[model samples]
Target: MSWEKSVRRVTPYVPGEQPKDKNIIKLNTNECPYPPAPKVRELISGLRYEDMRLYPDPEASSLIKALSGYYNVPEDQIFVGVGSDDVLSMAYLTFFNSDNPILFPDITYSFYDVWAELYKVPYKKIPLRDDFTIDFTEYYGDKQPNGGIIIANPNAPVGIYEPVSKIEDVVAHNPDSVCIIDEAYIDFGGESALPLIKKYDNVLIVQTFSKSRAMAGMRIGYAFGSKKLIKYMQDAKFSFNSYTMNRPSLELGIAAIEDDVYFKETCNKIIATRERVKKELSALGFTFPDSKANFIFAKHDKLTGEELFLALKNAGIYVRHWNADRIYDYLRITIGTDEEMDKLISFLQKYL
Candidate 1:
């Protein structure tokens, strides 16, 4: 049998390739090159085989408690999911009704559009400004009724961030519908929109352990919102998958949260590396958007994004290339260790 009409219209999201060989410098995905905190490894190592036989806690109480303490939000205001992508998907399902269109930036995480199609929700893509920054004026001027909004902070590929105040202004103006701030990369440098949740019942903030905490393999993400908003997400979660976070991931997520020092240090290192990379890229006649995430979006006047991406791949380094209309010339390169970045710079100097 053929797939449904909605599936026919959908273009699936393409994640960065995870190569089998460990030799490649994987700078395509914005994953931390560093390992997770020692405590997380220790906890995972100590997990009993018996725990695998039983089902994980459906509520993931300990993880929720730890996150509540970490973010200073109440436990009832939190909802845990397999990953921030999962959380985003749930939010799409939970908040966006079939009658109203969902709104997001034209050049965003890309998955946002996919999720909308998967859920059969109508959507409007608001284009970014000429300089690659989001124009809130165009977004809110649409005057759509009963629709929701989602934007990635320090937004993917572009790596530019919206100030917390700007996000607050948007939420204040749109009290009638949900406003989701996907902070998947916020820990790198962007200020969180979590504080806005206290004032706006419509605000929902999504975060993950994958990037900052070096827990991509664990697949743990959580959302913070008003109790009423979180309840709807919880209901959606129950309907889709009652227990998204497994036992080992749950335990290690708690450990990762408890070890705040490790998390901060790792994130600081990535930020430092990012700054250095930006400086070096500028010196090479490459212009990039101001970055607040672990990655940078850069393009050289002499080269196309696809050309640079292919050259890097040939040098055993992988970076992401977007051929989307306005951003076709830019490459999204993730920050790795000092040595790895040095290698990348050296390669670019010769190639460009």
Candidate 2:
């Protein structure tokens, strides 16, 4: 403990409990219940043993090209990393160098503040409204004083989405500050702010394959922004780690993006199941904000979030719960497959 006083001491962010038992129904993490695209498996199965000897593409060129083709953004404007966590962490280091406090929702991805603290960057968490909706006025670039901004479109845990026009307002007006729109769950039911990049050089739209692409284990995430912004991030990434994406991940990420039909199909399936579950939860006296992401933020009339979370855990069904203020009563349930959801609903019927 006394190794070095100079070593930075900081409390790290805790992730969702990943139970070891494979038999348990895990909806705690918002991972895609479906398997990765068939092409991903096919590509992995065909991976060459000789490929691992050398390092992956330092810049993730081929994967970036694949993303450019799929998202229709230029390659130079794209940047890929191990995951959105890595991308966001690098972004915080690269862009949020100013001494002023960075702004984000009080109840957000949690990692936002972790990265901010890890890098010793100043940050402020603006509280969401009573209904769990963000006040765009609080983050207005022109009206507010800020060093940087990051908003999760179709925000996590809460699962609510902000309109693209509202998001564009923040970007367009914040012409000087760096504005990042984290779109990890945009594939579920929200409109992406990706197109805004063309109009605003200060904006960066980050997306992850973990949710919709069913490649959480593969760990692929990317960002789209102006070439100038990407260039700065790219330089920061190389300075940190040249080869972030492994060869297998790069290949599989490309495969996942290529199967656009399968991608849409999987996302639609989750969305359909989410809508159906909403009705059933409502019948059980639960109320929640309309979710556009892959999860639902629900609170029951009688059942406390802690009670339900523990009860479900005892029953071997897992859902996410937070102990934070304003949302302590809510449970964040990931939309699993139809059968898994049916099981969850059936199990809850006894309590109803």
Please give the CA lDDT of all the candidate structures. Answer: 0.89, 0.91
Per-residue error at 47 for model 2, in Å? 0.4
For model 1, residues 256-321, the per-residue Cα lDDT tens digits are 998889989999999998998899999999999999999998888888889888989999999999
Identify the runs in model 1 with alpha carbons over 4 angstroms from their true place. 1-9, 141-146
For all predicted structures, in order, the TM-scores are 0.97, 0.98
Best-matching candidate per lDDT: 2
> Candidate 2: what lDDT?
0.91
Q: Give the local distance difference test score of model 1.
A: 0.89
Candidate 1 residue 237 Cα shift, in angstroms, is 1.1
lDDT of 2 by residue, 1-352 (tens): 5778789767898888899999899999999999999988888879998979998889888999999898898999999999998888889989999877889999889889888888999889989998889998999766677889999989877899999999998887777789999999999998899888888889999999999999999888899999999999999999999999999999889888889899999999999999999999998888999999999999987878999999999999999998888888899999999999999999899866
TM-score of 2: 0.98
List ranges where model 2 is wrong by over 4 Å.
1-4
